[model samples]
Target: MVDPDRVLVPTLGRPREDEALAYALETFPDADVTLLAVVTPLDAPLSEGGVLERSEERTARARASATDLLESVADPTATERIRVETADGRPGTVIPQYASTEGVDHVVMYGHGTDTSGFVRRILGRGIAATVVERTDEPVTVLE
Candidate 1:
């Protein structure tokens, strides 16, 4: 709660991403914001832009989508700079590690959503935001 000046917003190309990104910008209008999209192993029906693609293609698409989403939702009233980044790994692991290594003070993210099923959570425990909250030292703001 140190009045975050370095904010990290992790997105998954979901609709809820608008809320998280906007909240981070509006809440910390002067903070430097980074929008990250972690590309994980694909499942059977995994698709980017309604078309299935390979891992490399998927990673590229994720980056583009993250940048586009950030651009669309960013607060025009804020004067802070915004960045977009992408990594290849599981969100629960990569997000926290990135936050630690990059000195991210605040993390604005979404809770478990339609992408993950209930049975999966029951077996695997917490989702991305919950896992990051449990693992990272940075203060996390889950905008579910």
Candidate 2:
């Protein structure tokens, strides 16, 4: 059995995530896959409510949304190897941190293809996927 310690799926309310998750299951049947939902805090500076307060609110919503998204995609009858976690932090930082602490051996993710327009945006927009690749020592499989 291929024991992939962790599989990270970056979701943004897109249907493609289902396909990605299914693919991961098929690819690593015995691997322990944890669907990671990274909640990126808002970029604006601290205001009346304070930075920490705003961050907390954003984090709460993100966690709730992540739970809903994962619940919608998960197969309850499937094997017990799958788990879900939501973290409030930068994607690049949080993903690798979780993977390292969790002893992840693999990172499976789906990449958004280039839009109909020229390839520049696609190339440049691969930051998240690329960052994950660069930051982690584990193998990464990016599905198109």
Candidate 3:
């Protein structure tokens, strides 16, 4: 079987996001998996600290959380195959950008279903999966 060499899974701390990562690992046993989380800075300060300092702190926390999520979902024996990452920007834009820059072979993302509608969805359209599909040439696997 031809296995992907590099797989990127963009997660948003959702249950379905974890499911997508699990599916990717199971399907491509030998691939190098990266669990990525994108942190978009809020217009309003997220913390009382200085903007730059708070952003840096938040990014660090996000990286740690992403790493923990990856560890929890990945098989103990396959722990060495997975890596954790965090980027600063919108998920849709950052995911594909990371894939291209890092030479990712494939992207796996989770959909939040069609029933919900809100400002975020309006801003991002069909969400990260759709944006990544439109922006990248690499293969995309979407798990709902």
Candidate that scores best on lDDT: 1
The estimated TM-scores of all candidates read 0.83, 0.72, 0.83
Model 1 TM-score is 0.83
Q: What is the lDDT of residue 23 in candidate 3?
A: 91
lDDT of each: 0.79, 0.65, 0.77
Model 1, range 1-144, lDDT digits (tens) per residue? 467879999877767887888898888887899998878766422223424677778888889899788768765555348888897777778899999999999999877553677887776666667778999898998876
Q: Where is model 1 poorest over a 10-residue stretch in terms of lDDT?
A: 42-51
On the 0 to 100 scale, the lDDT of residue 6 in model 1 is 91
lDDT of 1: 0.79
Cα shift from native, residue 42, model 1 (Å): 2.9
- The 10-residue segment of model 2 with minimum total lDDT is 42-51
Task: Give per-model CA RMSD.
Answer: 3.2, 4.8, 3.7
lDDT of 2 by residue, 75-138 (tens): 7665477776777666767877888888888887766432334565564354556677899888
Q: List where candidate 1 sits over 4 angstroms from the true fold.
A: 43-52, 76-80, 114-117, 123-125
lDDT of 3 at 135: 93
TM-score result, candidate 3: 0.83
